[model samples]
Target: MLFAIRFTDHQSEYNVRKHYLNYHLDWLKQKRGVVLAAGSLREKHNDQPVGALWVVKAEHEEEALSIFSDDPFWVHGLRASVEVLSWSLAFEDMLKD
Candidate 1:
C-alpha cells in the first residue's frame, strides 16, 4: 500500500534537515519500497521547504514507520510531529513501468 508521511520539524529544527540531507537521500535510495515523489513542501507564498511529502509502498504501517524511525532527523528528535496515512493513486499513468 502507498503511505503518505507528513512530518513537522521541531522549533527551528529544520537545520537538522539540511545537515542530514545526503544521508537521508542515500537511505531512501537503498529502500526499494519507497518512492520519494516530493521532498520539499514549500510555503504558499515564498519558496521555502517547511516539511516533506513522500510516498511509500510497504506491507504494513509498521514497516513504513520503520523507515522514519531510522531517519537521522527522527533519531535526533528533530521531528516534532509526524502523520502517516494510506494513500491511493487515482490517476498515475506516468508511474507505470
Candidate 2:
C-alpha cells in the first residue's frame, strides 16, 4: 500500500524545523526503500518551507503511521498537524520505478 503523509509546521517553528532537518533527513535515508518520494512544502511567494510531504510504501495504515511517528520532526514536535491518506496512483512518470 501507498500512503501520503503531509505535515504542517507549527507557526513560528522555522528554527525548530531547521534544527532537526538533518536528523529528519537521516531518518528518512534509513528508510529509503519505503520512502518513495519526499520533500519540503514551500510557500509560493517567498518559497519559505511550511511543511513536508512524503509518499511511503507500507503494509497498512498503522505501519504508515508508525513511520510518521518515528520521524524526528514528529518526535520533536515541529509539526502543527499531520494528515495521512492512502494513495492510488493514476499515472506516474518519474516514480513509476
Index of the highest-TM-score prediction: 2
TM-score attained by model 1: 0.79
lDDT of 1 at 3: 87
Question: What does candidate 1's lDDT look like per residue over 1-97, in tens digits?
Answer: 7789887767577678878888877876776446646475767757556677777777889887887788776787667878889988888763542
Query: What is the lDDT for 48 in model 1?
Result: 52
TM-score of each: 0.79, 0.87
lDDT of each: 0.74, 0.86
Question: Candidate 1: lDDT over CA atoms?
Answer: 0.74
Give the best candidate by lDDT: 2
The residue pairs in collision within model 1 are none
Can you tell me which runs of candidate 2 are displaced by over 4 Å?
A: 92-97
